[model samples]
Target chain A: MTTHLKRWWPLALLLALAAAPYSALPLPGLLDGPLGSPGSLQLIALCLLYGGLATGYDLLLGRTGLLSFGHALYFATGLYATDLAMLEFGLGFVPAALLGTACSVLLALVLGAVSLRVTGIGFSMVTLAFAQAGAILVQRNPGGYTGGEEGRSAPAEHLPDALIGIQNTANLYWIALAYLVLVLAVVHWTVSSPTGRVWAGIRENERRVEVLGLRPYGFKLVAFTVSGALAGAGGVVYLLLTGGATPQAAGSDATLALLVMVVLGGSGTRWGPLLGGVLYTWAAHRLGDLANSGSVAELPSVLRVPLSQPLFLLGTLFVAVVHLLPGGLAALPARLRPGRAARAAAPVTAVPEGAA
Target chain B: MNTVVLLTCTGLGLGALYFLIASGLSLIFGLMDVLNFAHGALLSIGAYAAWWAATDGGLGFWPAVPFGVLVGTAASVLLELALIRPLYARPRDQILATVGVGLALPALITGVWGSDARPFPQPAALSGTVDLLGAAVPVNRFVLIAAALAVLLLLRLFLARTRYGLIVRAGVEDRAMVTALGIDVRRAFTLVFAIGGAAASLGGALAGLYFGSVNPSQGTGLLVFAFVVVVMGGMGSVTGAAVASVGVGLVQQFANYYTAAGLGDLSVVVLLAVLLLVKPRGLTGRLA
Candidate 1:
């Protein structure tokens, strides 16, 4: 009973924390300040959306040990499908989102079945190629549903009133928050289940798992489908927030951004991706804004130019995280606490010696 | 008949460029388990270097080619030594690190060179058209084809006859055995990476001449193409990379000729996906 309570308490606390801003209850000064701003609320919502995407990505990457370079194909599909359903078919958000996610799952199953034939880096390359192909097709807009390069916005009349109306900032935030919780709950349930153990085994050694009579390929495909569905769901939230979808959202850049979130937050941990997504999105947003018009502009042309490109800093951050902090930001608390760093280092130091 | 011949020639020229980039990619992966995502950046750097040498340094194309190769080689060696060496045992981290480098380098290129693409200036002598099978082709196109063939022959001869080539091949087959045999296999990998960088840069310089212009974003697209070629050829097979590159180049060229604006690129990617689905080991790769 105690163990079960301990396990459930953190989740309950997290849900309350997420809901706190929407509630009328007064909070601490620091929390109250940021929660009150419409812009801050919107930013937080965006971070949650990204966090949700990263959580899904970790299912394939961290659990199944698949590095899919084209996962954005699913994201694009979700957004595009949802947009088309709402605009062209006159469907509501819930039905449109469900339909879009279904399409993304179908696409993932097809892509996964074909790609999983090649292991490791080959899988990454195949997925990348497919994604690139998908991006181009969307850019071409043969059916005119995608709106080509300009990217069509949901007409004000077409959207569900709250999503894009004047009250949108708060409405979008709550909606994104709700989706985030749902996605996280699903991921947590899936990872803790018996199936997730098989995925973990496959990640460690496919041949060994195969020898044990488990089908690694089918398991990987299921993980891919689930991850794709989650990413597609994130896309639906993104549509709700921005009211539009661009081909760029499904490009390799977005894939890299999502990868950074997953890796930075702690790839295998349940809460790590969510933490990473929020931190990364917030940092990127703040940094981009800060660099554009602030003290950065005063620097010399040579100095400012490289700093001006937001991705340079992002890339540098990713490298630093990989090299210095193998476990990512989520591991920092354990490392930073007194006496814990030594304890962590002690076991790690013995590992290489044993291998050698 | 003219269209056919012209398209064929166009395809070969593009194929030659693809081979230059893909062969190095194949070789580097063969020797060192490193994917070198930054290789595309090396190509772009080479193109920009040659462009700089020709326009700013007032050097001729021939001199600029070597300069670009040198710069590219140095950069690649630096990357291998400083960044890649420590992460050799961890492929996933290596991929991530290299990807970070890949992203950073292009942004750096944009910062240094500005965001705009410029037309690559060709030498006055080679810019003119030459007659080929009742078709008018640029002299530079023939020049590119010859250079590609010459490089392929040299590579073949090196692999077939040289002691170092034998060592590289032996290492690829079994690194542990080669290490036990007292060869410093890591040093050989560094050499292979340098050579790969040189090849990519040379190709980049020539690609600029072929395509007539380049920009920072060019590396990203080229990286994808190189990956397709490497995969289609089977990883770690130089000869297979060469053959697959030609096929890819021709398909891309023909697709561009027949299709609307962006579909050519789309078709190339689709072709790679379909081919990969059909032949996972690539056309000539060994299944270990």
Candidate 2:
């Protein structure tokens, strides 16, 4: 029983974290400040939403080795679909979410078919261009459905009473937690399956996979579709939490933020992105607050300028992480212990070769 | 016919600006196999530096141009040595690092210069419109064209006449061979990057004068256009960049003239899509 528990420790730890907000047990001071505040639950919910989104993103970037720059389109598709359904079509939460996810899946299908033709850097650029076009199209708001640049919102009447009332923190937290867990299960199943093996194979060597008589394109399409649908679902959760959606939600910045989250968390690992989402969101919030305040000005003048700019820190962190910790936060535990070199040399490494 | 001539000249002038910006991008990529996403940041830095020199240094517009180019070249050299050197072999990290620099540079610019756009006054000599074959065109447009021609001529002469230029050209075709021949490929790459930086800054200064303003966000749009031109022209070919810039300029100008109000930009997106699908190697690039 002890050996079995040791093997499943990570999952067990995650479960404990999922229950932390509702546990009602007083966490120590540092944890209490971040998790016990009235608004802190919202941050957790955000982490879960982004974590699910990043996990979905990894299905392409990590699992299939495709680097798409316009993935926020799928997330936006889901949100806008939900927003339109709830506000314009007068649908309930479940129906609206279904509509959003279905729309995301359909859009993914079309995008995957066209974009999977090109691979590597060309593919990334094409995705970016398409995403920009998609954003423009949304801003145009055909038939006045998208609300243009103003964006669209879910009507208060369509939301569940609990979700509508911001005071229902526990309810919102549970729903977000459920969404994240569901995503983790789905991603875990997908990556562990035969489909996932083909994806990793494609990432390693596309030509060899082709020689093996497997049409990599079809498998890639599946991964793309799955990722889009997953990100779409995340978008729906965002709508429920925020009550609105903007075209900027699918812009380049959104894609970049998602990419940063995935990379920070360790791209290929199921749990890595979830942790990345939590850590990134928390860090951004904390660092941004610190930079905006007078406290940072007290530091050395030269350090003050860079420290105050959160983006500079984030960018520097990105470079440092890619260089120093190629396997991301997921590999840190293994790095800390003895015999680290052998573990680092393992072939199942998530870091892209020669990327450091 | 007058309107057509005016539009044609406008297209050429815009294309020249693109050519200046993209030539450096192309040259650097061809030689280093590194895509400097921060290229646009250098352009913006030049624009702002020229604006600063004109307004703050009291150097007036004409004298500030050289200062702007110098500042841009210095920044590019700093970027290459401090940030880019370590990530040479790592393509993905290079992209991310450059993107980080790209994001951070604008923030710094905004913090220093404030977010508002500042006017970049044109010199009295090039401020007015002139009649060109029955069309009233801005003298600035003519100057831009002339500047582009001058730079292109210099580049041609440098590549053809100088031993250093020969080394650069050889380095572009095959890095290993040049290295084997005992050439300092690193120094050649640094020179190319500096030249590219100067060219972009020159483009930025001209563009600032052309538009009558420089802003923190100035580089974003131009950077996108430069990237498209670099890719569309093929990665490393200066000639390809020049030709593609003109093509993009023509397409953009015509689209703005003919397409629906919001759809002008969509035309470029569509063009990029079709180009990628039909000929992924771009117009002149060998397949990667």
Candidate 3:
């Protein structure tokens, strides 16, 4: 009965979240307005969007243990391609999104083929270099397409009428919710499938998989391509939410931010990245708001300065998490339950020994 | 002809700065198996400290460089002891922690000093131009090249002659053997971090003169090129870093001048990609 309840809880939660728009519930301290208000919905939508993104990124980092630092390249590709398709080619929203996602997938396949040739830190560096190239291209704003550093906004005429204007924020929020659900479904299905077992094998010990007559490279590449594709789709949602593409979206820092999110959430776990992504996005936005609030301003300069910058606090928190919480927030519940913690710890310690 | 001469001079000067950052990066990665992402933050700290010393501390340009180097070295040492040393068991986490430091330090810098570029105080000696091969080259360029040369010579001497350097060299080649030989490899790790930080900080101080201004993001901006140099030169090889630094800097300068403005940076990245794909072991055949 308990196991059955645990399995069905997510569905129950999804239903409640879906009905959130109709409820005028005011979440004090967590949000400035009522739950159904545009302002609150917008923030929640951004959180959901990142939660989906972090989930996608976890496919590589958590499931496959491939630390590609260039995840932002694919995301930016989706964002820029979609925006440019609408602006330059006059394509409608759906077609533009499809084209952007295609671009991201194609780029991922090619780059992944090249990068997977090397393993470990070499792969990380190579991916970083490639992403830096992409960033430089966007920043260069060749032919004024990328708008250089300032970036370009989405062409409103090409977007569907429903996706535009402030009143349609709920629609955007729903779209974000749909994206998170789609990603969760895809990731959940893939992680449980045969390919996912192969990924776990590769993550634990690539040579063992090879000895078992399998090539790890192809499996790794599939993970990369799928993750990249998901990131691309997320980018389209992000463009809708923010109303534009910025060069920052294409940068190494963006990828680092994703890394922070995934790790903070707990990389390999099912709900970890999603919870992390939502909490992190919420904190980032709320911290920015709090920095501008009068109470923060009234504090001493030393206190005020660090509080003013969200990234500083976030980065420091990440460091603390790495030091104090190795398994991330996902492991916290397990830690609180001592009997379950010991049982969980047993297998985790045994796996390394078996692999070695 | 004059344009070529000027570009070459400036490129070599740029190469000098890259070498300073790359050399330390190579050593740290080689000895510790750590890609210290915070290396860039060290450079930024150095630049800020030097800028602070020269302007606010009233130390002037000549004395400010050492002050910056001292502060940067201290910070690097503290980082190694506090953050990195504890994470010795987890190699991946070490890199992540450095990434954290890399992120936080810049944000802190920006918080303290506004994000705007502060005009670097230039010494009169470095402000003037020198006639070099019919090109009016900035004296600062010559200063940078000279500083790089001195560092190269000193580094080579230390590595070739000193006992600690010998241990470092051995540690890079076979860490297990060095540890088995009853040598405390951890001490050498701290020393390497100190050396890398000092060199990077020194680069930061000189970089201010090179750019004529200091900004929080300068270290991170140069860090990409330094990574390229580290890859090209092969990890842990000082002489290799020197050669690759010159090659990368010249190529970037010439490419930027000959082709489009930003294409040079793109080309350099392309060069790194091609090089890695072609020869995974890098120039010196060092896999690390």
Highest TM-score scorer: 3
| C-alpha RMSD by candidate, in order | 3.8, 3.1, 2.0
Q: What is the lDDT of every predicted structure here?
A: 0.80, 0.80, 0.91
Which ten residues in a row are the worst by lDDT in model 1 chain B?
B279-288
The native-contact fraction of candidate 2 is: 0.43
The residue ranges of model 3 lying beyond 4 angstroms of the native Cα positions read A1-4, A345-356, B283-288
TM-score of model 1's chain A, to 2 decimals? 0.88
At residue A4, give the lDDT of candidate 3: 90
The alpha-carbon deviation from the true structure for residue A334 of candidate 3, after best TM-score superposition, in angstroms, is 1.3
Pairs with steric clashes in candidate 1: none
Candidate 3's error at B177, in angstroms? 0.9
Clashes of 3: 0
- Fraction of true contacts retained by every candidate, in order, equals 0.64, 0.43, 0.64
DockQ for all models, in order? 0.49, 0.49, 0.59
Off by over 4 Å in 1: A1-35, A341-356, B283-288
Worst 10 residues of 2 chain B by lDDT: B279-288
TM-score of each: 0.92, 0.91, 0.97
Better of 1 and 3 by TM-score: 3
Ten contiguous residues with the weakest lDDT in model 3 chain B:
B279-288
| Candidates, ranked, lDDT | 3, 1, 2
